[model samples]
Every structure is written in structure tokens, then in C-alpha cells.
Target: MADKEVQNSKKPPSKSVSVVNKTSSVSEDTPKTVPNKGPQVLCLRILNSLNENMKSQKERFEKLESAQYYD
Candidate 1:
């Protein structure tokens, strides 16, 4: 009876180890299945272009204001 109990205890540890291995493997695969970054990249590009346009507009406005002051 003592031997049977020892064997059962050993079996549970092995099962727990296998479960841990499976969870680790699943976690490793998660990054590979990540959503595509295409939309995020496109949005960043658009925001950058808008920022550039805003800067140019501000420069033009400043130039016009200075010209009016000099007139």
C-alpha cells in the first residue's frame, strides 16, 4: 500500500510538469499569432503627414503676419 501511494504521488508530479510544459508552449506561440501591424503603421504615417502639414501652415501664417506688420 505504501508503494502504491508513492507511485501515485510520482505520477501527479509528472502530470503537473506536462501541464506546465503545455502552457509554456502555448505562451510561446502567442506572439506569432499577433494581429497585423499594417493599420497601426498606416495611422502613424497619416498622423505624421498631418503634423507636417500643420507645421508648414503655421510657418506660412507667421510669414504673412510679419509681412502685414512691416507694411
Candidate 2:
């Protein structure tokens, strides 16, 4: 009886094992909404501000150079 039990335990699961089926409710036509624009907008704003600051700094340096050349 003990040997029979061990043999049964060694056997693989039957072919009739239940398979879990997963179905997605999302369809292809459904438009995916963006999660957040806060970070993206902040990054763009920071880039624009940096560009403007660089332009101003360049203008100031050029003006200083012209003044020194005239002196």
C-alpha cells in the first residue's frame, strides 16, 4: 500500500488539468489616455527658460566685448 501511494504521487498531473483563461476587456478602438502632462510640461518650460537665459547671457557678453574694443 505504501509503494502504491508513492507510485501514484510520482505520476504527472492528468491531461484534464484546468487552464485559467484570461480575457482583456480593452478593445483596439479604445483610445488610450495619457497618464500625466505635469512632468512633460515642466520639462518643456525649463528648456525654454534655459534657452532664453542663454540668449540673454550671449547678448551681454557680446556687448561687453564691443565696449572693450572701442575703449
Candidate 3:
């Protein structure tokens, strides 16, 4: 039959199924990555220092402004 002939002309989907199975097994055997937290903690400390510096600078500028207006 023409339908049988068409089916025979196309390659089967079995290879894709085997590929998926292979990837699943490989992923199971692979080790997952552990993230480094040291740098992250250091970065947080640096950001906090920068924020404190900015707050102090803002307070100093406000004091100067008030002093100028009072003179």
C-alpha cells in the first residue's frame, strides 16, 4: 500500500527515544555544582561600607547647607 511505502521511506523515531534515555542516565551519574558563598559574603560587606559612607556624606552636606543659610 502507498501508506506503508511512505512509512517505510521515513526513518523511525527510535533513535530520539534512545538519546533521551542516555541523557537521563548521564545526568544522574554527574555531580552537581556547589556554589561558592565566600565571595558573596565579601561583596555584601563592601556594599554595606559604601552605603555607610554615602549616608555620612549626605549628613555632612546637610549640616553645611544649614550653616550657610543661618549666616
TM-score for each candidate, following the candidate numbering: 0.49, 0.49, 0.48
Model 1 global lDDT (CA atoms, 0 to 1): 0.64
After TM-score superposition, the amount by which residue 12's alpha carbon in candidate 1 deviates from its true location, in angstroms, is 44
Identify the candidate with maximal lDDT.
2
Any residue pairs clashing in model 3, and if so which?
none
Candidate 2 lands at a TM-score of 0.49
The residue ranges of model 2 lying beyond 4 angstroms of the native Cα positions read 1-36
Clashes of 2: 0
lDDT of 1 by residue, 1-68 (tens): 99998888876444333334432112223233335689876665566666667778999999999999
Report the error of model 2 at residue 50, Å.
Answer: 0.5
Every candidate's lDDT = 0.64, 0.72, 0.65
**lDDT (tens digit, per residue) of candidate 2 on 1-24:** 999999989988778878899954
